[model samples]
Target: MGMEHSILVRVITTIMPALVRKEIQDETDRITGKSKQISPIPIHLSIFSTNDIAQTPYYDFLILPVVNLTLIDLPGLTNVAVEGQPESVVKDIEKMVRTYIDKPNSIILAISPANQDIATSDAMKLSREVDPSGERTFGVLTKLDLMDKGTNALDVLEGRAYRLQHPWVGIVNRSQADINKNTGLSFARRREREYFATSPDYGHLASKMGSEYLAKLLSQHLESVIKAKIPGIILLINKGIDEMESELDHLGRPVAVDAGAQLYTILELCRAFDRIYKEHLDGGRPGGDRIYGVFDNQLPAALRKLPFDMHLSLQNVKKIVSEADGYQPHLIAPEQGYRRLIDGSLKYFRGPAEASVDEVNRVLKALVMESIRETEAMVSG
Candidate 1:
């Protein structure tokens, strides 16, 4: 499932050119069908705006031969809105980046070109903000060949500068000129190796540098992270399987295939359900007990799942009381704080109440389904 260096470069060469841009109108017009950006039938609107902020669509590409890598190419980090771009574009991109990187599971790949100011790398800055320890962050330094005269990324390449848990691997990818000349990635890799081996500043560090090392490091990082998560994933999967098996056991055996048998089964199922319904009406166990459980069991279960303790912790309660006091401490209860706390706590009950109703509904529906399995075949057909 891993893509080799040559194959990866080939994919980049063919699919990952300078990013493709699309022209679009505003989201309001886009959704209202007043403007068709790209559609089967062309419909141009006169009131279309040049900068659209309403909708952002994800672009996906499928390569025939798959690799272990799954990439999410977000909008490039930028400080300014160039030319006709909307003013909010920068903030919007930063917000989107933050939403993804803030997640505990995501692995941040912070990349910067050698020519770019590493101190000002928005990608690394955002990564550090979300992952201050840099545990989940992997840094990449590209375009090592493009650095200014008499300068080298010796410190960064060796993890002495801008250190991350995973050290930065420097890459000397093909230039625009080489791409235009239709050079192959295998050839480009050879040149990359040659450049690193020959340069006096980077010659000794050739083993630790280049695209090959980056690919290996990335694969190892993903593997280690995935291995760490396997136990939790397996536990969830096993729990789901157990639940399914229990539900199946509750459903009992399947009905026969013969039409006559099915017809008889239907009658017997209806009678059984009727008997249970009558017993429940007469205050019996099978059906009547579930109704009692709605209040006694389901409601309590739902309440336990709510974060009442978290919301009403000592610190939080004190803060609320302080806020209610408004610069004056109360001798007795802060009546306003008590009222606010009660009101807030009461709102939490709404969810549990609704969940209890839903649980009862599920119990009823499941009972009905179990009683009517004879009709399942016809229904499915």
Candidate 2:
């Protein structure tokens, strides 16, 4: 019995994941403009273990694409009954459907009542309630063995058409005898099904647990897939300050009065800037050159006046690199852009003595934002 219950639980677990994947695929299609169908169906486990309804094994499952989200009222039929119960059932069914589907547009009621008379009253109340709203409600009542005969009988008495079929009538049905005969199930295999039948609640709880498990699995998979497709870019910049320290060590003039060494440092600095700029612009990095160009153009005229005669001081070189560091064009792209600009600007301008490099970086960031806004306007227009 335990083994049979395990097999049944496994089947539910396997099926629920597929259903969840289908829902995710449908949602993705709608977002990408490929499909118009939107399904309002809440992910749920169809509890087939209930004893009130005959257990009908499902052989095949059909996956549906996106469809408009619709409300579905599912009425549970047990022994409980009252004289004024039809209206209450109708209202409860409607509320349940709305909550389950989470859609206000279309509503469908799947009802199973104790008898034909009660089923008819329930259907009528459901139809009338939804009729004024101009939404169609389908009442599906299922029975065993007999298919269209029951539906036809109800149709004639109600003076309205009601489609009746077996619960698993739409699904391909096969008998246990047929399965056993075809597969040549041994004594051990037959015992499994018999064992599973003993534990009724096992199947029900497993189905609910399977649904929750699938929901979590699908959520995680979707998040991973999305993250893999879109990745963040990181850019690292380093000035050659370490190399200069080695050269200064060989010079005996307190590393300050060596004009030739200073000249070399300035040349190296200029080369580093040029290489970075060119790599960003012509190297085919995404948003690379466009971003680098903003900083390049924003260099102040006063900084450009620095002599390349190799006589510049350590203070000058430090000032140049510091100013360049402040240039952050990437921050001007959108909301992120504004935040980067504001942060960079505050950092560059907050001190009593502003470095020339910091001023240049701040101005460049502002210009980048302005340029982005203008470009956006042109595209939007």
Candidate 3:
């Protein structure tokens, strides 16, 4: 479990703030005891770090009140497939890394041993594949104390070999011997701090080395990313709201309550049509005076119920009385004479009278049809 313990310690040490590291250390001790099987399986470690922007005698106020950083441990990358491991395993790990780092707001921390040339490291290559500009990737040079004699990563840290936007940070990793000896993490951390401070090559980078410094650097980067993305996040939210509103407009409002409500609505619409029918058909209102259209239907039988012969004779008598010259001697009337007068009057008046009736009926029909269309719209709604 040497590799496993090393991986876990690296992640926990980097993620946990000074305030929460003790809790994790206690948990680790509990797990490694005689009852190791009952220990909770850790997926990722959550570490809380707070930076104070102001401090007084009473209390300190944090600039970033609380930043929770979660570190996920993935399988290490390998250039060549191992003897027992299938070639697909290596490819699968690479695919996983690519998928994770491709997320829009993701930042990659590429950890490499200082003894190896970072230019050829699989971790550094994966970082570049996902973040071509190197803007979202930070380098952590580990195992600095294990470098070959007369060899150092000063050039790599300074970005002479590979140009990284963020300068590389150096850290001394706990050795296999340290784990075999069961050295406490606190002792290991102090050893790391002393190694950087005393070593001539890495002494210059003392302030920028070690896990605590690395954690602070990551926190600052995370805060910067959050600040930069706030406006864009709000813009996306507003855009979503507008799209939802348009969809609601197309959907319209809900009004159907029950079968009876629907029936009442339909009846109310019919009543409005009834009022229009009475106004145009009985009152002869001529519906908006738009008298232009064709009418094929004949006048109703009720219109022809007028007493033709008696009404015509009365009208003729009134006309004669009104147009009398002096004497009234046409009392002795002939059948053909009455027929000629009546026929002439009918010929002059019939066409215009029928046309006027048809026109009025057409306007009334249009009004009724319009009312029906409006009712359909309401029912559909």
Candidate 4:
């Protein structure tokens, strides 16, 4: 059994992992015809010991109902080595959790028992290490009914305690007895709803409580994340198509073409490069404004920070004037000495100037790459 099955039983037991897209018109497409279907589904378990956390298995399941969410079912955090487990199991699990959470693109679902102290929660502790603002973390408090008779998790659910930018949800999960008797999730969910809807402590906010609400909340969150990334994905796809078309067109063209054709081809390539360059500088594209920022903000800022006073101090200026006027010093205006002093001081400006040029070059390269990925640069077809 996977690690998720344990906690998921108390939380999202009935809600199995789902497919991103589904088409069920043909039943034969889903089921195998025994001998004819030699290839099994892509789900596989590694041929390694279960105790080895590093040998984690992965699967690509063809599921229905189209939820489009994936969860990495990692092992629970441990305080010490159990009898059969490795001595470094606790550290190993913590390292594994951090590995997944450290990714900027991942969303963390931090679940903890409501009866325990939230301040000492291992899940939230690890989550905060990676996501200090709690932006990508969703806090789930399970076993709400397990708390003492006089105490409740009202402060946690309402955000008065251990406040987070993202909201927390409380769940009164089914007990061991309910699971042993094989009670349906619907009945457990009904009981959960009744507990919250009628409780003097939770009734005021019953609408936002229970497992059903949690499902809807997670669904909406996943949908919003997917929607946010769709535009960028489309841009990449279109850019790839444009690149392929251009490459094919170039390869198919004659190497021994007429002079007029060669000139036209050269003009076309130049025009394409020119248009892209202008659009970038004019802020007509997404990353276009960076070029202006490099010139206006960064270059000026770098120039201002140069040590002008140190470079042009009176003692240093005098030394340079003496070096310039060594043998044939200008008799009257001393133009050579003055020019030498000015040129020596100007040397300090070279460092910032070169640095600005390098920064601008890098920014232009990134801007040109992004412009090709923009809708305007992509092939229309």
Candidate 5:
């Protein structure tokens, strides 16, 4: 069976693997246990043998019925290659496990078989690296019945070595004989309780052994973690609410409180526009003088400063006539000719007038936008 089956079997009821229809079995056995009817045959099994991460959720009805918990059983960290896996596979799995354990919110559950050396286990070593102070890491010692005769993990369980904030918990997994006989998990749990209760070497530590006790301990630990983070969570929520309120204020509507107030604001804007228009037309200092004064006075002054002979030349008259009439000839009566010549004389000045009006209009638009911005700023403030 795969890790998914192992996990579900540990925490939930037994799920029988289908003997027929591999595809249907794979689809049906999701969450409970992945069907092994379609087992893959590879020349070599790497840490990424399946080339997928199994995200299994575990729920305990017997122990922490009211609380739900999720536990991840990562690939076993080992340099040994019983299945022809390369040595690099061990390192790759170590890196993957370290990435998850190093996260701030993670709680490390370092599971080491009691039959093995606790200090030498790769799982325990990795846990130490993530939790240097041993504050959040807990140990679960499995296969209590498999340990050699006259040997026990009492020292590790009692925290004499590999000390963690939460002491080690011991559990007994189902033996091969139990599995062959179709013995359920309840029997396995009862067997564990009995072994720890009667055995001279483990009876005193009965409170710390068995799956039920471990589940209850984990539930309590999670509750404490939630309680500890409540204040910080609340603080963040309040900060987000305040930020949203300020943003809403910043984008508030431009409408005034009442009709009279809105009318007054419109009138004030109209007056401002009128004042600016008059100022621009009159060559006031507020409007740059270049638009009106340069064409009106400077060109004439420069022309008058020229020598009298040069000023009276036909070329000069022709140039003025050409510039005024835009170089296009048109027949007219004497009276109309006088009016057309005057219009031509003022043709060069039309540019400045148009430019001045455009500038004033641009300034008025900017003032309106600024007033809106100021109103919004006041509301936000």
Candidate 6:
């Protein structure tokens, strides 16, 4: 149990953050009945004298050799297999490590994005084989060697012997320069539009035309569709129009055309929602049916008439049941049947709960105003 506790907490925390640091220490202390204590072991305990390498720049890097070391304990080889051979179980530790770490660009860095990618790739490769009983089996080993000149003292002390250097030198520097150039080009393009193309006079004209166009389209579409007259849809469209009007009322408003563009986007959204609602009501197939009504044939005749398809209504029901006979809704409410429509739409919009026309327009106007102010400041300052 002590070995198991240490292996689970120590190995996982090595990669993850210090959020679980206290929890792990508490658990370790509970199991071992030993309070944590700081050791005063000499930094160069592995060597007889540190004076020989004192003057070297690399000496600073070797102050603590093998600083953060962790050991993982895998009790037994249960579900283990080899690549391309499903029947082969790797009982040998050296063979398992060699197969896992030995590959093109196989040198694993201690702390890097590449480490995550490599670990995932290696896991996938190992997953190809199954245990002898045709069951999925795999286990993590105990030992890991993290060698990097930047963070690993062993690598710094040992130099080229332990440190795994990158294949192409100075690649990151070139990539950073390219990123900076792209950012500068984007900023220049934005400035040209703010100053030369859409000055105050033209910007206002454009905003008005765009807003009017969007408002007209929205009112027209809502009337044509939503045949039963959805009050919510109507309210949203009117609210959008009111928002556009409020923005126009602002004194000395610049880029009025861009304001119109924002209003039009709202109008188009109303049209889209109307179409989606109609389709949903019309029994258009939704993505990945959670509604188990399709499998109603398997249910008893009396239970089948229960309006709501509980299995389809809930997620993960299919996985819990062996066959259709075992299916049951833990909670069945008649009003909850249409709850999917509201939830689905809310998710689709990805907007705030108070997504009114005026708020959206105000938000857009503020954004445009900020952009204009920023460009002016950059040019002047």
Best-fitting candidate, scored by TM-score: 5
Residues 239-355, model 3: lDDT tens digits: 999999877655555555899987886687688667655655555555553543333233333336445566468677566444443354455554444565566666655665687
TM-score of structure candidate 4: 0.51
**Clash count (model 5, backbone only):** 0
Q: Which is better, 2 or 5, measured by lDDT?
A: 5
How accurate locally, in lDDT, is each candidate?
0.71, 0.39, 0.68, 0.70, 0.65, 0.35
How far residue 30's Cα lies from its native spot in candidate 4, in Å, is 26
Off by over 4 Å in 5: 1-68, 84-87, 253-341, 374-381
TM-score of each: 0.54, 0.24, 0.54, 0.51, 0.64, 0.13
Better of 1 and 6 by TM-score: 1
The residue ranges of model 1 lying beyond 4 angstroms of the native Cα positions read: 1-69, 267-381
**Model 5 per-residue lDDT tens digits across residues 23-59:** 3344335532542221121111111122223444663
lDDT per residue, candidate 1, 291-338, as tens digits?
778989878888888888977999988888789989788888799888
Q: TM-score-based ranking, best first? A: 5, 1, 3, 4, 2, 6
Q: Which stretches of candidate 2 lie over 4 Å from their true place?
A: 1-8, 11-94, 101-109, 112-120, 127-136, 141-381
Query: Which candidate's lDDT is highest?
Result: 1
In Å, residue 185's CA in model 1 sits off its true spot by 2.3
Error (Å) of candidate 2 at residue 69 is 15
- TM-score (C-alpha) between model 1 and the true structure: 0.54
Candidate no. 6 TM-score: 0.13
Better of 3 and 4 by lDDT: 4
